[model samples]
Target: MTDRFSQASGTSAVGGVERRSTRSWSGVAWPTLGVGAILALVPLWLGDSRVMMGIAVLGLAFAAYTIAFNLIFGSTGQLFLCVGALAGIGGYGGAILADVVGLPIVVSIALSTSAAALAGGLLSWVAVRRSLGVIFTGIVTLIFALTFENLLLGLGELTGGESGFLMEAGRGTFLRSQIPPYYLMLGMVLLTLFVYGSLRRSRFGWAFRALRDDEVAAELAGIDVARYRIFAATIGAAILGLAGALLAFTEGRVSPTTFGFAEVDVVVLVMLAFGGIGSFLGPILGALTFTVIDELLVEVGQLRVFIYGALVIALFLWLPRGVVPALDDLLRRRRAGS
Candidate 1:
């Protein structure tokens, strides 16, 4: 892990001073663009099938969520389990603002995203201030997730409760279209990748790697652990919120199931685990792989969650750090042998 971080961070000692290598940044940028370009070609093949295209858009949204979650859990050691809840805030908040309050869609999305970000930041602050461990942090966040769901149900008049809330803001726009929304979601995924890659090559990434490796050591080395964790959570939550809001507008509805904990959080966690935590392409790969798997598992009906649980157990037992990091290690070893 230490060696991997050192290499990815591109640090070199010269005359007792640490310098970053531009090679790493270039390496990251090209691959990111290549991946984006490849994904951009999906619509060419699937354009005719409305159902498939819709599913693809949803897959892209999950990819976006994985990226945001990767930034929070993969970057820092923060074990936040409220991924769905935070996104629910964005989706529901945007729906209420745009449909009920008569606010513009853009304004509603912005405000909702901001609210999610603030909520995430506050959650992180509480965790840090209380010196919560990973398990305790997860527990707290899980509780918050449940609470958010109950809150939505309790305020049925506003949120539309179990029946869900129908949104009319982007009804007549391109958001309701199959192709355009797919591209919009794809663009969001690409933009998130760019931002994530940029961060990985910056000082922030260095700090994140440091803290993740060892919080006490990172603090001793002069990194502000609390501030950086909060920043990551806030930024990730903002992305989650924005994605959720856009999805709500695109679907023209907001429902508890859309951002339910079991629906979003569990899936995202599995995706991140499969992708390799903290690896640049991990989230995208995981989301793509699992999206296909999930689609196939639709036939199983109630057994899907059971399969997911089994997969999680299997992954943690055999490939705990995920596919990308394991493959990276294998390649490095093979090169050394050569």
Candidate 2:
């Protein structure tokens, strides 16, 4: 009877923690959701389809991707450098399934996402399961990224290779414009945020936090470091892959240039560095800020790259952990002073 009672109490305590987490997330979510709603309406005021589609919609997609990256590197403390490549795998896989194999869009996306998840799990097993150090693990993933790029290029007939290929736009349209995809991307961003918050509150999250802080201690605590590392990697990759499938549908094309290592991998890392990793607002803020900056600098052509590089350096110098954490610290200080 005592053992049973103890188990019941433990379960209830876990339940209470979950409830508190939900409440905490709800407190933070309201402001973020309100801001997002306002941004969603901005497209109507601006009345520019290019701006709406290019910056707003694509930024939403990239935010999802960035969140995925942050989870693996920031939360789990495992640096898997194949973010865009997994996304591309999902993109190309779904495109082929939907466009070529005549599968339904839903089925195509599901299958592709599953494929990405499997790949992520396999990557974790191959790279980190043997207890490889962090730097070597990154190198292995980077090699996978390079290999994936080559595979896509080599499979010209399927993935359009260097020349690129257009997707059949038979579905995913709304009101004869890009609005539907925009909303779709927005929905995805919200979903990713929701999952991120839930994870942040769960025992899984605590495990990640512990693992990130000290693997040996986490293992001693019975956290199963290898299992959770794979969990984080697989979950993040699945989110990224799903975003890629959505992007393939949105952009209506698959190409090598779209998923280049330097093009996406570096850009995402820089965005995370700018946004503050391991925080909920970091990925969204970073992706949106960079996308807008990119749009503004569009007319400047080559100068934009130089400016971006300079800005990143400056941002690091000014706010080492990115904007959100710095802002959070400022708010805390102000409150304490008051």
Top TM-score model: 1
Where in model 1 is the C-alpha error above 4 Å?
1-25, 328-338
List model 2 lDDT by residue over 91-200, tens digit each.
88888999999898889999998899889888887766677667887999999999999998898888778876888844546512556667778878887877876787
- Residue 332 in model 2: lDDT: 65
Q: Which segments of candidate 2 are over 4 A away from where they belong? A: 1-25, 28-32, 169-172, 315-318
Model 1 lDDT tens row, 70-133:
8998788778899999988888999999989999888999999999999999999999999897
Compared with the true structure, the alpha-carbon lDDT of candidate 2 equals: 0.75
User: Best-fitting candidate, measured by lDDT?
Assistant: 1
C-alpha displacement of 69 in model 1, angstroms?
A: 1.0
Relative to the unseen true structure, what is the C-alpha lDDT of residue 131 in candidate 1, on a scale of 0 to 100?
86
How displaced is residue 187 in candidate 2, in Å?
A: 0.5
The TM-score that candidate 2 achieves is 0.88
What is the TM-score of each predicted model, taking all chains together? 0.91, 0.88
Structural RMSD, model 1: 4.2
- Return the TM-score for candidate 1, rounded to 2 decimals: 0.91
> What value of lDDT does candidate 1 attain over all alpha carbons?
0.83
